[model samples]
Target: MQNIIEVKDLRKEFKSHSSRSGLKGAFRDLLTRNYKVIPAVNDISFTVTKGEMVGYIGENGAGKSTSIKMLTGILNPTSGSVIVNGMNPHKEREKFVRTIGVVFGQRSNLWWDIAVQESFRLLKKVYNVPDDVYKDHMNHVIESLDIAPLLDKPVRKLSLGQRMRCELAAALLHNPPLLFLDEPTIGLDVLVKLKIREFLKEMNKKYETTVLLTTHDLTDIEALCERVVMLDEGKIIYDGKLAKLRSNWGEGKQIEFQFADIHVKKETLDPLLADLDAAWTPGNQKNVWIANVRNDEHIISEVIGRVVASNKITDLKVHEISIEDIIRNIYEEGIING
Candidate 1:
């Protein structure tokens, strides 16, 4: 495998202006200008091999967008270097633009009044794609995305899901080897999201396109990317296999149990469930108790045994740690301990 994108010690900073608060504060801020240098992206380095799908994930304002902007040549790095497709993206903007495709979820790249197919045609002309090649590519994308019926529909008339499909097709029509997708599946229903994920997977397999995906959706990362690069506060915190992240941060298990009565305060039950890290709360306004047991495999059995020995139990259930919880734990506590 060859490297398609290489970033070395990349750093980006932004000047922050003092924010106006009340009317008095606003007037004062206008009179006296103040600004601070905020590091949007600290020293971070990574490489993407040809045909690899890499997930870039982080919380809001965590430098995910800044990194993507630098990669796409929309912004220059304050220091370090970025090479995409054997060219420095900032120095070779024209040549690099032809080899890469970008899709921003919050914005539209298609004309509002034109039909979806019209947008594709315009893109073909803009990219100078050959007639035959454009037609074949357009047809393949439309069919693969199941947007055949949507071709004749105007961009403004289509639903969000439909519009998103067309946007993806528009970006991919040029057959760029590297694609940068920012929240491609944002704000869609479960079924539509699944459809988009499947489409992306098939596209990668068919075209061998290298993808750099930035999204807050963990499902997207789990379904599409084997390697994940996590960022926080403009710094690269974790870069490794997704499975390893799960194994390390996903060790804790959650157990929920309902008891017949709240005879014992949750505090009292804590002593009996000392072997397991646990928290007990009132299940509802009722007398039943709900206990959240953590890090104990025999949590249910132990709770059952303890309740049966002392009181009575009605219902019990246990669930493994979820990916959301794992990521949350990582963000709250550093991954070194989480």
Candidate 2:
């Protein structure tokens, strides 16, 4: 497979003026000149092949937006290189952008005063899409996104979810080969998100479009992407299969047991709990105990056995670490390697 997006040693920087905290310092600083260089994207390199959906994820101020801007030719990198579809995004701006579509979650790409279908028609004219091709893409987007009813309504009058559906449709009207979605599912209801995810999956499957999705929502990553590229402090940290990341950095399992007796003696359970090396905590109920067991299956089994033997377990439930928790651990621990 050919790579559609290639970035090598990509870097971006900005100059900041030094500012003083207090009134006196602020007045004195006006007489002097000083500047600091901040690196927003530091030596990051990765590639996305045709027809692959990859997640580019990070916490706030982690250079995710900066990298995306550079990739989309909105902002030029301070140094190094970026190439998409055999052309330099910044140098060949007009031609490069035609091959890709971008959607920012908080921004509106549609004309607010126009009806939804009018917006689509405007995009059709802007992209010079043929009559047959426009109809084909429009039909697919409307059916896939369930936005047929929204077409006649004004964009400003639509709800957030409805507007989002229309925005996605407008972006795809050109039938671009590459899609760049930044937080597309942010602030959407679960049902709307599910619809968008399904549409994206079908778009990739049926049209062979390459996608680069940037989102804080791990559920999006888990459901839509096979590979992920993680950035931290303006540098590339981990880029690999999403499953491998879960297996390597996944959090410990959780086991909750409900006992018959509410007044379980602390001392009586100390010795039994001491053998399990797990982080135990009190559950919501008085007769409940929750333990964060190790990732190892054997240890989890042994810990459960010990709990069951000591107390009459009325109910039990076990769960693996959630993707959100795993991502939290990654940000907290600053784990750079998988």
Which model scores highest in TM-score?
2
Taken over the whole model, the C-alpha lDDT of each candidate is: 0.84, 0.89
**Over 4 Å off in model 2, which ranges?**
21-24, 257-272, 281-290, 295-298, 308-315
lDDT of 2: 0.89
Candidate 2, residue 242: lDDT: 89
Per-candidate TM vs. native? 0.87, 0.90
Q: Please write out the lDDT profile of model 1 over residues 79-160, one tens digit for every residue.
A: 9999999998988998899998888899888999988888888888888999999888878888888999988989999988
Lowest summed lDDT window (length 10), candidate 1: 281-290
Winning candidate number (lDDT): 2
**What's the alpha carbon RMSD for model 2?**
2.8
